[model samples]
Target chain A: MRIALGAVAAVAYAVLLLAPLAVIVYSVSPGAALEIPPSGASLRWYAGLADQPRLISGLFTSLLLGAIATGAALVTGVPAALALTRGSLPGREAFLAVLLSPLSLPGLVLGLGVLTSAAVLANATGIRTAGTLLPLVAAHLLITIPWVVRSVAASLESTDPALEDQARSLGAGPFATLFLVTLPSARAGIVAGAVSAFVISFGNFALSLLLASGRTVTLPVAIYETVDRYQDPTVAAVSTLTIAAAVGAAVLTDRISGPLKTRDSSARSGQPAGPAALEPNR
Target chain B: MDRSRRRVAGLLLLPALLVVAVVAAAPIGLLFRVALYPPGPVAPLTGGPELDSFAGLLGAPYPSVALRTLRLSLLTTVLVTLLGFPVALFLSRSRGLSRRIQTLLIVSPLLMSVVVRAYGWMLILGRQGFVGETLAALSLPRVGLLHTEAAVLLALTESFLPFMILALAASLDRIDPDLLAAARGLGASSARTFFAVVVPLTLPGFVAGASFVLVGSLSAYAIPALLGGSAARTFVMEIYELVTISFDWPTAAAASIVLLLFASALLGGAALLSRRRSARTFGT
Candidate 1:
């Protein structure tokens, strides 16, 4: 009964995730080529995407924005994580909340806030910040940094703070202690956080839409424009690419994080776990 | 080792804090400030009344838009939470590779662009989309799912389901297996054991997931704009058009203020509900 249940669940999930993409793939049915199930398939739409300069440029812009935002997030998030966890700073809990508050704040409100501020600056000083790549990067950084902070913070929680103290007592400076003792222990978390941040910035569309203009469109916004204007298989091709990246990153992260431990053992092991791994009884 | 290091750490956080202030807080503060002012484009910066925007927003189209937003958000919250509960429960019951697959399946949506996901549903639910064709095949009356409240609801549910599932799964995992066993050993059926044992303990997850989904959907623009069509509008869609297309910054800011207030109120309600659930669970 359990096996049957599991099998059913798996198939349901597979269909839920794959069926939509399959629909798009099937739409590309060419007149002369072999057809896919549920309908015919064609390569013409796939060929058409190659000529969409906006789509191509949008892809480049998205990649660049993700790279910049993720890079900024790592730099900022890593230090914040270190200070919050390792340091004996006063009001550590308060600082942590402030860092993580972005997780709770609605992105729509945040985007509007940023836009409003840019408008104010332009109004006051004749300085325009809207529809620029910089604003897009900044907006994404606002949303993406929290993931790294949480990931690094979780990793830091698992590590023995005593190790840092021991190194300090053994005559290492604060910087050396962090580099030698603390960082090594939380390397997995940091790497995982960076990867997560990269995927997040890459996948982000909301900020890109509000901040991007003609030359600055991201892939998601481009796809949005294309679909809104023309209901064709090109949208499907782009969606397929996105789904592939999202699914691939998720799977890769799971592989990197390794297997879930039994509840008691995982708690005993003191390893920082992701949201999915925290299931009761592991 | 003393104050200097502490100060250094404090100073190190300055850049990040600056980014937050300029990027996050400034915009929010501006939203509130402009919301209180009059609408209809600023007249150069010479000198004008500060509260005109607020008056404009309270008048006419703004109030109606705000009310419509509240109605749509309430519906989206209810639907997402209801659908997510069963899925989250189903996830908590899996193990080994099955659990991994479920987790991947659930979280993968978060990785895809929201716009792309919205677009995917557009193809599926639009007049000429898959759902329409499926209905046609069944020889059923043609059902127009797109450009309706139902369309918005479906897209919101899909976009927010991952959040609910993750939250519920997190909270459910906190349940002690022995408690379930004890319930069963007492001759309780699986269904009773699940309801009496599992649901009570995982209320936190439910609250967390529901709140996240609610806040997310409340401020949602992409799904509504894409699926809901021009006539089927939400507040966020209204705000976006007002600011960008209409170039009505003051009214946009005012609308955003209303959205901000609405979001905070819903979030507060979720918090209170969560606390009450926790207290009740512990009291027993």
Candidate 2:
């Protein structure tokens, strides 16, 4: 039974890991035809990406949108994380739940809700918000804030509170103590949160699909449209590039936050560590 | 703890709270209100408030779509859990470099976009793709699986398997080896000890992983749309169609509410189940 289970698991792992690589492999295949094992290797498909105007524009849009959203989330979420961890406020758990509530929402539902809200605002104020970057940024903020809050909060929780108090006692003001003491200690978490926020925003599809106008098309939406219209290797090339970028960011962040993993493990063991606890990109 | 300190904390929290209120909370409230409006041709809320959209959901097609989504999500959850357990077990048992390598293998794909992964499955399962080619090589009739529920299930399972594995691995790592040894020392067989000690201990993780997969699959848009096409119309796809194709925003809002309810119920039920089980296990 154990052997059978192990065999099944091995097959499952291969399928889970190799299927994504199939795209990467196909991207570098020489010909337009997608053969599993290409006759030869070339970067023709990668070069072909340059010819896709929609995809190129979409990539820039997604990058700019992700950057703006990540910046907004960090600016808001880091301070909130600090306050939640160190503020000694009443109803802290309730406040934390409210802040993290967006993580529990389905992207589609949230997207539609925001779309409706934008329509209502436009109707009331005679200024359209849909088909613009405003709604997209708002929706992405909702998605990214919980991640920033959770990551930074988890980091702050591990540090000793006395350090901040000691800094305060040594003539450091509140902001100084926060900047020099609390914020510095939570740098790893801040970096992780920023990466996660950016990645989540960059890869976001359902929300962007609803909120994005024709002019503001994001990469994932563009890829979806391209694949729907034409089954070709260019989409594969675009996907491969994204995969490379995501993996690169993940590795870099993992190296930076390597020491925190050991500390995080003990705190994480007590919880269920659901998708929200991790990064729920979907 | 003092008033001034509390005020500072509130000031710090104001930005996030304001953003959430504007972006998430108000919008959801507006969604519920929109659902109450009668479905109008020109605008969603032109007519007086009525529950017509909610009533429309009880009609044909919506119920069937909801049921299909539920079945698909349930199947995906079961498949992911079954596939995740042994892998999680293997991960929990491994150490050092091997563990890190295995972890990377499991998590790297997760970092990739869902669209990319779904597109990969599309290539593999398309008519001129790997599966069809393999069938041709075997002298068998080529069958197109790209637009089938099975293909969507495969992609969804693959997409969510990492989450299940991670959740289960977290719980499996927490299992006290001493408890397992105690069970074995008490003359329990290996299988007996696993069932008696390990399974119960991992139940919380199982619940967490199961809820995530279930909710995720229930609301999954890209995978089902790409793989299942018209054959497997999920609830989210139905909602999408209602908004974009049908131009029926009220019905779409009502449908979104229904999907939200379904997700909330699953999550709430899982939370209750986990709490009860933990309370019993820990004797709290």
Candidate 3:
């Protein structure tokens, strides 16, 4: 029974690891058609990426959108995290629930909701928000802020409160103590949160689908379009690039947040560490 | 916390709260409002509040779509749980570099976009792809799995297995090893110890992970869009088609609300179940 279970697990793990790698391998296959055990491997499809203008532009848009959304999330989310962790706020659990509610919300529902609301606003105020980057940013913020708050809050919880108090006692004002002590100590969490926020926003598809116009198309949207229209290796090439970018982000997040995760006893106890803690509803 | 400090905290929280209220909360409210409106041919909201769209949703096609979605999600959840448990057990027992490598393998795929993953599945399941090629080599008919329910289920299970494994591993890690030793020392069999101790203890993680997979599969758009094609239309796909293709915003709004309610009910049920189980176990 144990051996059978082990065998099942090994196969499951192989499927989990190989499914994504299949795209990378297929992209490098030296043929126009997608086939396993290709005739030869080449970077021809990677070179073909330059010919796809929609995908190139979509990549840029996705990057810019991710950066802006991450920056905005950090600016708002860090302060809120500080307040939630250190402010001794009343109804803290309820407040946290409200802030993290979007994580549970289906991206389809959230996207439709944001789209309808944008339409309403456009009709009311005559300022179009649906086709622009505004609603995308807003929806991305809704999804990303929870990560920021959770990460920073977890980090802050592990630190000694007396450090901030000591700084205050040693002639540091509240703001000075916050900047020099509180924020500095939570830097790992902050960076991890920012990285996660950016990745979530960049790879987001359902929300971006509802909000993206021709001009605001993201890479995922472009890939969807390409796959819908054609069965070429270019889509595989694009997906491979996306996979590479995500792996890079995951590595960066681990490098920065590894020590903090080790220090987080609650994470060790039951909670999944890093970006896996909360489902981003990709 | 003094009043001034509390006030400062509130001030700090206002921006995020405002953004959520405007973007997240208000849009849901708008969806509800739009759903209530009478459906118009050209305009989504022509008349005052009515249930025409909701009534339409109860008729043919939509119910089947909802059922298909629920069926797919439930199947995906079960598949994920079954496959994830052993891996979670392995993860809980492993240490050091091995554990880190295993974690990276589990999580790196999650970081990639669903679209990319779905595209990968397309390659594997396509007519001239891996499965088909293997079948051809076996001198059998090449049957494309793409656009089938099985393909979607396979992809969904792959996408969500990491979540279940992580959740279960976390719970398994929290179990005291000595409890197992005590069970064995008390003359219990290994299976008996596992069934009585480990399974009950990990129930919360099981529920949490199952709910995530269930809800995620229900709301998934990319997998169904790419792999399911026209044959296995899901609830989210219905909502998307209604909004974009049919341009029936009121019906789409009604559909969105129904999906939201379904997801929330499942999550709430799981939360309640886990809480009650934990309370019973710990006597809290």
Give chain A TM for each model in order: 0.83, 0.92, 0.94
| CA lDDT of each prediction against the hidden true structure | 0.70, 0.84, 0.86
lDDT of 2 by residue, A1-282 (tens): 656656876897798866677788778878777664458898888888889899999999999999999999999999899889888899999898889878778888899998888888888999987678999999999889998998888878878889988998999998898889999998878988898889889998988889887879999999998887687888899899999987786676656555566566433463222122464848
Candidate 3 residue lDDT tens string, B54-156: 9998887988888998899999999999899998887777776777777777778889998998888888888888888778878889989999999999999
Q: Which runs in model 1 stand beyond 4 Å of their true positions?
A: A1-27, A31-39, A123-131, A169-171, A259-282, B2-5, B41-50, B134-142, B181-193, B272-284
Candidate 2's DockQ is: 0.57
TM-score of chain B in each prediction: 0.86, 0.95, 0.96
Query: Which runs in model 3 stand beyond 4 Å of their true positions?
Result: A1-5, A270-272, B137-139
The parts of candidate 2 lying over 4 Å away from their true place are: A1-6, A263-281, B40-44, B137-139
Per-residue lDDT over B82-192 for candidate 1, one digit per residue giving the tens place of the 0 to 100 score: 666666667777667867777778767777777877777776776566677677777787676788877787778777766766777677767787888999999999989
lDDT of 2 at A175: 82
lDDT of 1 by residue, A13-37 (tens): 6534643574355446453221322
- For all candidates in order, state the fraction of native interface contacts they contain: 0.38, 0.56, 0.65
1 or 2, greater by TM-score: 2
CAPRI grade, predicted model 2: medium
Error of 1 at B265 (Å): 2.8
